[model samples]
Target: MGYWSSVLLVFLGSCSYGVLSTFVKLAYQAGFLPGEVSGSQMFFAMVFMWGVALLFSRRKVRGKQWLTLAGTGLATGLTGILYYQSLQYVPASIAIVLLFQFTWIGVIIESFIERRRPGVEKVAALVLLATGTLLAGGVLAGEFGSLHPVGILFGLLSAVTYALFIIFSGRVGHEISPYTRSAVMLTGSVLITFIVYPPSFLLNGALTEGLLVYALPLALFGGVIPTLFFTLGVPHVGGGLATILSAAELPMAVFMSSVVLHEKVSLLQWLGVVIILVGIAVPELSHKHRTAAVRDRG
Candidate 1:
């Protein structure tokens, strides 16, 4: 039941991210640049985090742990920046496919940590996941006129950094309260975002306009809630299963676009969604078989 509860936590976190892109698109339509979008989210997220930390995360962050958590948070910032920047040179379809590579990357990292190669079941699940991501992202149907080397580099970098962040989040600072750790991490994200896109524009009325237009939704859906859910849940689930569960975001996004944006989802896309969900369930559903295989190997 505890494991299933962890799965539910990851599912909820991934669901928040599923609807995040729509809010981001709304912000973009309101004329916010990527930097502005990222920064405003971070800035507002910091405020929300601070309030949450004060209320529940009363524990003070110490020396190295602060830096460690902050650094992991900064990696989250980079993941957003790199992914968004990649879209300038590549289609969103390709970029989405690239970001989803973190699924297998997480598996590899976990294999090393556990000092055992993943069984065939895990590998099959990853292949199914990648296939599903491609279909769900519309990469199978999108035209690619050109894939810029720089954009591809950024995309791959984002995937690696994202994988590392999940691994780090699950493994580090086990003693800290989730609220406090996530708040500290968000502060790190805010600093990194500010350094890249200075908030001086806010003094010139950008803040009020952005806030009025899109801050609350973006901060809540994209920033505060997802971070809180992932931080609170991943440690219990471990990085591998949590990462697999994160695939829930793509399918949820497809559903959201269809319902809210009135976008059409292709038959192939629906199929992909089903496959991804099945992939997420594979490990848990096949637990006995996997354990038997492990025992046989030993």
Candidate 2:
């Protein structure tokens, strides 16, 4: 695929993720706890992805690759748990903002692993992202005052776990096909969620009528489609660009909430969104330019 085509696919996949939160909220309002919704979604996602994999690829799935997928799934599942728990104590907007700190986390982790620091552009992007998050989350005005300390802690932990997922997924990209990778990750998530909250499925009677209806769409959109896309696109996009594209989810969430949930968006939040976009875009554009320049020189 062409570079721009890959970039567009990544962008679309990330935007899909961005709009997913509202569906999650709808599921929650329907009386589904985070564990139940997330667990069920992954379970169904695995089934769907496996079906696709079986249809398309005759390649044998390897044992070590399965292990790597499990590890990735575990990381992905833990991040979900942390994020969902954080949502219980904080606003979705704030929780999302905290989760997106993964961009900086990715940069720092890459720096340590690669034994080289990020360039000036990356540093500036990180700073802008931090500032934009503060503004977008309304933390600057102490809006997070309502959030529990434990929730905040989990939010940060989610970012760390999520960053780890990005790193590990990138490393394992060469070893497995995207479909196989997605299936394994989903299977891992299923195991963890079931083990951690075994009773979630058993408590179906406790859920509202509304939640049952919501889960079907939520699982399809939030869990299945996006995971398939991420699995397919991330390997092509690279983790850093993937992270930046995924940040698009925040603005999408905000826009969706405003339209669907009728939530009010403040001026500062809009400004923050613009700033965050610029922060993410700058690095991507710079990288593309540098790549083109190198090609020209050669």
What C-alpha RMSD separates each model from the true structure? 3.4, 2.2
CA shift at 284, candidate 2, in angstroms? 1.9
lDDT per residue for candidate 1 within 136-209, as digits (tens), equals 76767764335688878887888887787777887777789888888888888888888888876577687777
**Sequence-dependent TM-score of model 2:** 0.91
| Candidate 1 Cα misplacement greater than 4 A, ranges | 87-94, 145-153, 262-264, 288-298
TM-score of 1: 0.88
lDDT (Cα, tens digit) per residue for candidate 2, span 96-178? 88888888887788778878877887888878877888888887787888678998999899889887776666677465667
Scored against the true structure, residue 250 in model 2 reaches a CA lDDT of 78
For each candidate, the alpha-carbon lDDT, in order, equals 0.78, 0.74
Instruction: For residue 293, give model 2's deviation from the true position in Å.
Output: 2.5
Cα error of candidate 1 at position 138, Å: 2.7
Best model per TM-score: 2
